[model samples]
Target chain A: DTAVSQTPKYLVTQMGNDKSIKCEQNLGHDTMYWYKQDSKKFLKIMFSYNNKELIINETVPNRFSPKSPDKAHLNLHINSLELGDSAVYFCASSQDWGQQGTQYFGPGTRLLVL
Target chain B: QQQVKQSPQSLIVQKGGISIINCAYENTAFDYFPWYQQFPGKGPALLIAIRPDVSEKKEGRFTISFNKSAKQFSLHIMDSQPGDSATYFCAASGRTGANNLFFGTGTRLTVIP
Candidate 1:
C-alpha cells in the first residue's frame, strides 16, 4: 500500500484559473506538510499541519491556502494562479513534529500555469 | 536565507566507484540532517539521516559522515550501481516549535555501468 498518495498527477490551467490538489496519508501520522519544488529542484516548505492545526506557514503568498480536514488528509488550493505557480507540489506526513520523526512523501503533482 | 548548501550540483560515476555528495549548514540550531533520494516523476524518499551527536552512520552501501564542529555532512555511496542514479537532496531542521526543514538545492548522481 502506498503510504502517501496525491491526486491529479498533472495539472495545466490558465493564468487566472484556480485549482486544488489533494493529499492523503495512511501512516496515521499527526503532522502533514506541503512542499513546493521549483524548476531548479529547490524544495521549499509551504505549510504544515499538526493534527489538523496550522503550525508552520512560510513566506508563501495568500493565493495558496492549505486545509486539513483531519489527521489523514491535507489539501492545497491555489487561487488566481499565476505563471510563478508552475512547479511540483509534494505532500508529506510524519508521526510527529521535530527531528525525531521521519517524513514520507507522496509522488507529487506537477502544476503548470500558462 | 539558504540554511543548507550542497555541492556538485551534478555528478557522474562509474560502476563500483564511490559517489560522494557534500553539504554544509549555516544554522547552528539545526540538530537533524537527512539525505533524500528522488527518481524522475516521483517524490523524494529518505535514504539516511544523522544527528549532531553522531559522527558517522552507515546502512548497507550508503553512509553518512557528519562533522559537528564544521557543521558539514556528506553522503557516500559505495560501489555505486546504475540503479542508484537519482537526484539527492540534503536537508536540515532545528528543534524549534515549527521544526520545518530547510533543503539544499539538490545533486543529480548518474552511475554509468
Candidate 2:
C-alpha cells in the first residue's frame, strides 16, 4: 500500500488559470504538509496542517492555499497561476511537525505554467 | 530559518567506495534526524534515522553518525553501487506526537562503477 499518494501527477496550465492538487495518506498520521520543489530541485515548505487544523503558514503568496477536509487528506489550490508558479508539489505526512517522526511523501505533482 | 544545512550539493563515488553526506542543525530541540532517498521521478523515502542520544546507528550498508554537542550528523553508505545513486535528503524534527519536518537542500549522489 502507498503510504502517501498525490493526484494529477503532471499538471500543465496557462497563465491566469486556477487548479488544484490532491493528496492522501494511509498511515493514519495526524499531520500533513505541502512542499514546493523548484526547477533547481530545492524543496521548501508552503503549508502545514495537523488534525484538520492549519498549523504552519509560510510566506507564500495569497494565490496559494491549502485546505484539509480531514486528517487523511490535504489539498492545495493555486489561484491565477503565474510563470513562477511552475514547480513540483509534494505532499507529506508525519505523526506531528514538532515531534520526531519520519515523514512519508507522495509521488510529487509536476506543474508547469506557460 | 532553514533549520537544517546539508553540504556537497552533489557527490560521485566509485563502486565499493564509501559515500558520505553531512548535515547540521541549529535547534537543540530537534531530537530525531532522518535520511531520505529519492530516485528520479519519485518521492523521497525514509532510509534510516538516529536520535540525539545515540552516537551512531547502522542498518545494512547505511549508517548514521551523530554528535550531540556539535549538533552535526552524517550518512555513510558503504559498498556503494550504481543502484544506490539517488538524491539524498537530511531532515530534522521533534514533537511528542505530530510530524512537521525541517528539510535540508538535497544531496545528489552518483555511484560510478
Candidate 3:
C-alpha cells in the first residue's frame, strides 16, 4: 500500500489561476508536513501540522494556505498563483509529534505556472 | 541563510568506485542529521541518519561519518553501482518536537559503468 499519496502528479496552469493539491497518509502518523523543492533541487519546509493543528509556518506568502481536515489528510491551496509558484510540492508524515521519527514522503505533485 | 551546506553540487563516479558527499552545519542546536536519496519523479527517502553521539554509522555500503566538533558530516558510498545514481540531500533538525528539517542543496550523483 502507498503510505503517502498525493493528487495531480502534474499540474500545468496559467498565471493567476488558483489550484489545490491534496495529500493523504495511511501510516497513522500524527504529524504531517509540506515541503517545496525548487528547480535547483533545494528543499525547504513550508508548513507542518500535528494532529490537524498547525505547528510550523515558515516565510511562505499568504497566497499559499494549508488545511488539514484530519490526521490523515493535508491539502494545499494556492491563490493568485504566480510564476514563482512553479515547483514540486511534497507531503511527509512521521509517527508522532515529539519524537524524532523518520518521515515518509509521497510522490510529489509537480506544478508549473506559465 | 542556508543552515546546512553541501559540497559537489554534482558528481560522476565509475562503478566499483567510492562516492563521497560532504555537508556542514553551523547550528549547534542541531542534533539529528539525516541523508535522503531522491530519484527522478519521486520524493526524497531517508537513506541513513546519524546523531551527535555517534562518530560513524554504517548500513551495508552506505556509511555516515559525523564530526561533532567540526560540525561536519559525510556520506561515503562504497562500491557504488549504476543503480545508486540519484540526488542525495543532507538535512538537520534541532530539538523541535515536530522535526522541522532544514535541507541542504542536493548532490546529484551519476554512477557510470
User: Candidates' DockQ values?
Assistant: 0.75, 0.61, 0.81
Clashes of 3: 0
Give lDDT tens digits, candidate 3, residues B1-113: 89999998999999999999999999998999999999999999999999999999999999999999999999999999999999999999988657888899999999999
Off by over 4 Å in 1: none
Q: In model 3 chain A, which range of ten residues has the least summed lDDT?
A: A50-59
Tell me each candidate's TM-score.
0.97, 0.93, 0.98
lDDT per residue, candidate 1, A1-114, as tens digits? 999999989999999998999999999888889999999999999987786357655589999998888889999999999999999999999888654568899999999999
Docking class of 2: medium
DockQ of 1: 0.75
Which DockQ-derived CAPRI band holds candidate 1?
A: medium
Inter-residue clash pairs, candidate 1: none
What is the descending lDDT order?
3, 1, 2
> Best candidate, DockQ-wise?
3
lDDT of 1 by residue, B1-112 (tens): 7889998999999999999999999889899998999999999999999998989999999999999999899999999999999999999998986558789999999999
DockQ of 3: 0.81
Quality of model 1 by C-alpha lDDT: 0.92
Better of 2 and 3 by TM-score: 3
TM-score of chain B of 3: 0.98
RMSD of 2: 1.8
For model 3, the stretches where C-alpha displacement exceeds 4 angstroms are: none
lDDT of 3 at A27: 94
